[model samples]
Target: MKIIGFKINNYKSIGSTENFLSVEPKVTALIGKNESGKSNILEAVGKLSFDRPLSSSYLNNKNRGASGEVSIIVHLEYYQSELNEFEISQANTSISFTDNRVVKIEGGLSELLNDDELLMEAIQCVLEMNIRSVWGNDSNRIKSVQDYLNGLKAITSQVYINHSARLGNLKNWITNDYTSKEDLIEKLEIIDNCLTKYYSLLPSVYYREQYPQLEASYKYDDIKNIFKEPNHIFNRFLLAAGITEQEIVEAFEDPIDGNRKTVRNRIARKIQKNIEAEFNEFYNQEKIEFQVEFESRVFKIYILTDDKAMNLSERSNGLRWYISIFVDVLSREYKNKSLVYLLDEPGVYLHVNAQKQLLELFLRLAERDNQVIYTTHSPYMIDSRDITNVRAIEKVEGGNTKVFKSAYNQNLSNDSKMETLSPLVQAIGADLKFNIGPSTSNNNLITEGITDYMYMNAMINYLAIDSALNIIPSAGVSNINRIVSILIGWGCEFKILLDYDKAGYNEYDVLVNKLDETLEDKILFVSCNEEVVKEKMWSNPQTIESLISKDDFKKLSTPYDGSSSSKKLAAKEFHDKVVNKEIQLENETVSNFQTLFEAIEIQKHNIAIVRD
Candidate 1:
């Protein structure tokens, strides 16, 4: 299941964080400056998959109920078994599931309280727990506690291995303690004590060194087995890169059989070759190549150099930092068969060109059906056209995280990037290009499809006295509003002639409001009454061609069927409706050259003279 979007409330400095994610492009970059809470977003997503403690200390007052309460809504996008759209929103500390189809465990801390009474009861129960089991003999109270424990366990069981930070510690504990004759708690306590003693001197360390094997039990051995499983190429690469080559070879030499060693060797060789080819290609393209082979067996990595990839250790920092995170990322990639990557500031160390390469790599990964969640501060990392997908993340009142998105247009031309984006301090954030107009043009008109624009233009010219107007066809109704705003911003007067229908009216009203209230003057809306057009103009085959050929008033007023009444009726209606709407002088604050009503009245008088 790929997470498409999520929001976190009452979690750390984030009182509320709501934003959508790009799931189609497997690699999503969660980019922001240091302390912009980019890492917090990753933490929030991780919490969705696991019941890890959300850091709530940053909330104004930790004493408040909000401190311990974390509300996270994770949208998972997956193909259903039937291959249909399957999306579920899982929310924490909320009333009822965002998706009702998903069930909630009873007596859970984050209860799916469908009613107010249940929520109140759950709150009351929470209060009672702090008072200590005063009535030790209370069987109902004991049962409640037991139920709560069971529910909590159920939640934990669904969590994945990426939740834990201390990998090494878990691995050491598993290797030393398993198979010993001791109770589970005793064994755990012994392992914890060892970790505590070792961490006393160097306290930052957490996680087991060995991969944690997760299954029906939370035992260290259980996780270790999965981590040690040679099938995972990522884990094997991690092991090969971390351990001495001789040691890795020795581990699989005798009892383990040559097959496992052969596979491990092949995997390592493949990784080495891929890295080498990528690096060489960097140089062959006239880009620089940066490489660092750590003398120790702990880690080894290569860096590609280019104009964008300047600064080896100082600017880009060593590849080790990224490599360090890669172990976790790669492991999680395999552990969760369908995993979404959350990479924050991945190419900070790489040059601009290298960053570009990384983005291309991510695009390829996306094609492979892997969801990548990546963030970048570099514009080079982002596709200029997919600007709507870009979300501006900022700090709002009460230290909450606020997200702003482009509602009008999804694809942004490179030239319009700065204007499209509000340029917030940081934003963690694609679409089709409808070729309505040349990208180079500052002034553009977008309408609803080619046919709509064609008919609209025909109507305009037929009623026109004289005007410098450009008519453009659009992909659909949705595109008209966006194009109008852009044209208006560039000091162009535009009129949208759409069918008098629901979808057309909705777009018309929306654009009127967004563009500017006074746009009614410069921007015109002309709608053709479909029924009238069908009965009058479309009924006679020769009539349309006659109207087309006879551009002058005298010929136009002359009836095709030699009937004066039909000609007069068509002239009167066309003058009253279509011509009148285009030149209405409602918003006098802005001038559309001449009043449409006045123009239509003039045309009517002329037609009268022609008929007489």
Candidate 2:
């Protein structure tokens, strides 16, 4: 079973219904400022995988005042086949069979077959009478009954099939006549044994938690001992790296006393090659090599860079932290077993780029069908392109924590919550600044906000244009002029694509008057106005949201409920649908977007020609 999501209640800093948090299946990131309860969400989620009671320290102070029960409910998704297996396993344990000998008796005689002494005596008397009657008149009938009884005895001799078949026969006999009490109890015991084995083979949920303290130490002896254990995470790493315990022991064993350490050197080189191969997939850094040596009956790890070797512990804090945690995770006792991994602020000490590499590792692990839930405030850890994965946590009134799907609800008006949302805000701002701010790329498109960037990029990719343009989003239309001024000062060639509404027009006019005439051509508006768009596309106001087809527009509008913030949320949903391909673009809508791309491409071509 995979955990789809979960709900938390009465946990620390989470008091009431408003304090609950929802988790995503693959990689759920809990992001908020310090003391905003991001870690609390991770802690609560960890509690669900195991039957552990909440520590008294974690009980919500606010809820304790009201005597509320602290609980967490996890929603799981599994195959019907698993349920069938469990049921079949349960049924196998309760199944019973009877002795085949009892089933062969004739009906009139079966009624008198309760006690062992009486039944045997009656059967012998019937056999003697039948034999005498059939001795010369019906010898064939006598032989047939004898053959049937012999076959039943032969079947009962086979141990594997005998017990169940015997139980079945016993059950059938019990339906007609009472059986011996000892025989009935013996048959029940047989069923119990079958069930015990069946239940043992059934699958169960496995949970593992990796705390930061586990990765804090990297001493060679400690690392070596960890690899010797079967279930240690480091052992898995070594196995994945193509090293065996026997080989490790051999490397430590010196065949020659002082012969340049040939065995240890060869193993270390092999390990280095494997380590580099594994780490390079996620980490972008200078080529790293490892050296393993046995000194004073202990193994030491050294890293080689620039032809110089340094102790592994001497590496940067970020690299050391990453390596330690990576080893710990990879070495998990149940790494191969299906499990839900709960990581709390993992890689917190890593550099921004290393944290990003750590995110890549999380994705790789998740691809193996395991779910990962982690908490982080670092923007690098958040996939900005897919903000739907983010769940923002904040402290509300009465010291309660609340979680929000930030991408689903863009215009969260509560200013008090904004402080807690600073990490996400900074993440988006960083993304914008990195993509469109002073850089080598000359072609850039600046839009009003995330929705515009989303729609425009989706259109650009859908059209498959070859333009080398980077799309950036200003906080809003009011902020567009400041971004334009900054780009102009940087001597960066950029195009301003704005909404065709009054606010957008006002911003465009103000920006034009502030900049010189030379940069005027870089500014443009979306193709259609409110009146023309309403007549052609069946939507009003001519905003980017209106560009979507009527059907999608209706779907987006369902969640708005006439609230201003809800309208912004609806726009976010619209953008997500368009980008995720959930909403099919109408031919007319595609044509309109194609026209926009054509305009931007033509502008880019003209600017390139001018520069040439």
Candidate 3:
């Protein structure tokens, strides 16, 4: 199951005007500046969880003043097969076998019985038939019905079942004036069980924030009691370790009962193995070993690092935070269940790289039948390649928050919102600028931006020309001179490739005048006939994209409706075709690129000869 999208109304800064935010199935990043209601969006989505509901305090202050009711709707997509399977399982199981199903049925029946006498009669007759079929004799019918009804009543008072009604509050219908006929009531219980199971198969939503610190001095009794709650797999494992009541009593009396000690050690080893496995999935560091010890009449957890033992509390804040969260999540018995995770500012305390690891962890978790929506101002957390996954939350003039599909969309002109998008922009910009990886190669080629880098790098690799030469993109035409200067200062042998535009020529002139004459040999431009450019071009400024034939240009830009940005994007597509060997280059285009490549190689050879 997945959450496709959601809408929020009268929730804090999220007014009714711009409340809808479409969520991606895998990872949806909520990008916004502080106070832009990013957290509010997460909170509103969280209220859709069965465990969480819209509260009075959650109402927007502005809406409260206007006496408007707060509303939130979450759109979900679920697999029909899973729902069918759940229904089948519920149908096969009895109410006494599953307390959760019983409670939901009771609650559902109670609400349903408020009206609809005809429906009630129909349900009663079905129940009577079911009871008669299951318990053949009338003598056994009363005891059986009383036992099933008692079980339902007991669970209804104690447990809060998370299933919603399937057939218009049928559980409420059953609860309302349940027939005294034992057989009929038993049959009704079966129907309620099926309804509850059907509801459980639906996609569930869960809200997670930073975990709180657990008490340090918790003894075996405390751990044992808490572990029995069935919250997570770790707790379940501990409970399954068979820590009997007699064992607890023996531990208090002797503090070293052999059987009790063996169980504790076995549980500790199991937990350590699981934690290490989870940790290594996201982090590659020293192999972490855990030791569970009973000291000072308390259960203590410690980590073994470099053959030295350290208490979990003694670890760094980041490590502790990771462990706490991992353990907390591992403790959840429903981890494998399909869930929509709404994470608000996750990994705020971790370093940038660790936060990146956390992002990887989110992806890994999402791959396991889950969708994760998180809010982050950090660029490391954003997947720049898939900008479509980003939703920009911006504060409007009236203090209402609006969400934009993409931060880079030209439609969003708000200066503050743009500022909020800075991290993402900078991240992508940095990637474009430093196309070369760390290496000792002296041959470096600097281009304008990603498109230029992509085109040239593809050509270089296709031609197998000087594989050692690093291709670096300056991010923009204007940054070329400054980047060249830095490369020169680093004593690197480099060549600059710029477009054939007026600005490109101007920057070339400025750099030649600014740098020493000795370095002037390194500067170059894309060679295209000025007469041909003037005759064939539709625009004044000629870029490297102008090198393509007019027919090919038309083919590329036709899909984009001839817009400049679209043309630029189309140019990228054209480059991809060339790189993939899909397009046969014209003789003139091949000659032009060959001339450029030769010029770059000649410059490198000349520089090397001069140094030798």
lDDT of each: 0.39, 0.55, 0.57
Better of 2 and 3 by lDDT: 3
Candidate 1 stretches with Cα past 4 Å from truth are: 16-39, 51-68, 80-270, 273-332, 405-612
User: TM-score for every candidate vs. truth?
Assistant: 0.40, 0.63, 0.60
lDDT (10s digit) by residue, model 3, range 1-612: 455667666767777766788777678898888998898888776755433334445543334322355666555554445546423221111111111122122322233232334434544565444434334435554464545444334332222243233222333333333454454445455546553543454356667754565333466656667655654433533433334445444545554577667766665666657666677677655567767777766767687888999887887787767666656554543444677778888777776667777877777767776788999887777754334467788887777788775454444545784577755654443233432221335566777765566566545544545446666665467777776666666566677776766667666667876766665577666663323243233346656665555555555534334475664456455655655566655555554556666666634332211111
lDDT string, candidate 1, 174-260, tens digits: 323234313322433443343232112110101222322211112223324546566443354445234334444443443556765
Which predicted model would earn the best TM-score? 2
* Top-down lDDT ranking: 3, 2, 1
Candidate 3 regions exceeding 4 Å error are: 50-53, 60-69, 79-194, 214-217, 220-256, 333-336, 384-388, 429-612
Model 1 global lDDT (CA atoms, 0 to 1): 0.39
Higher-scoring candidate on TM-score, 1 or 3: 3
Off by over 4 Å in 2: 1-4, 20-25, 50-67, 76-274, 332-342, 407-426, 429-442, 464-467, 474-493, 502-523, 528-539, 551-585, 602-612
Candidate 3 lDDT score relative to the true structure: 0.57
Query: lDDT of model 1 at residue 64?
Result: 33
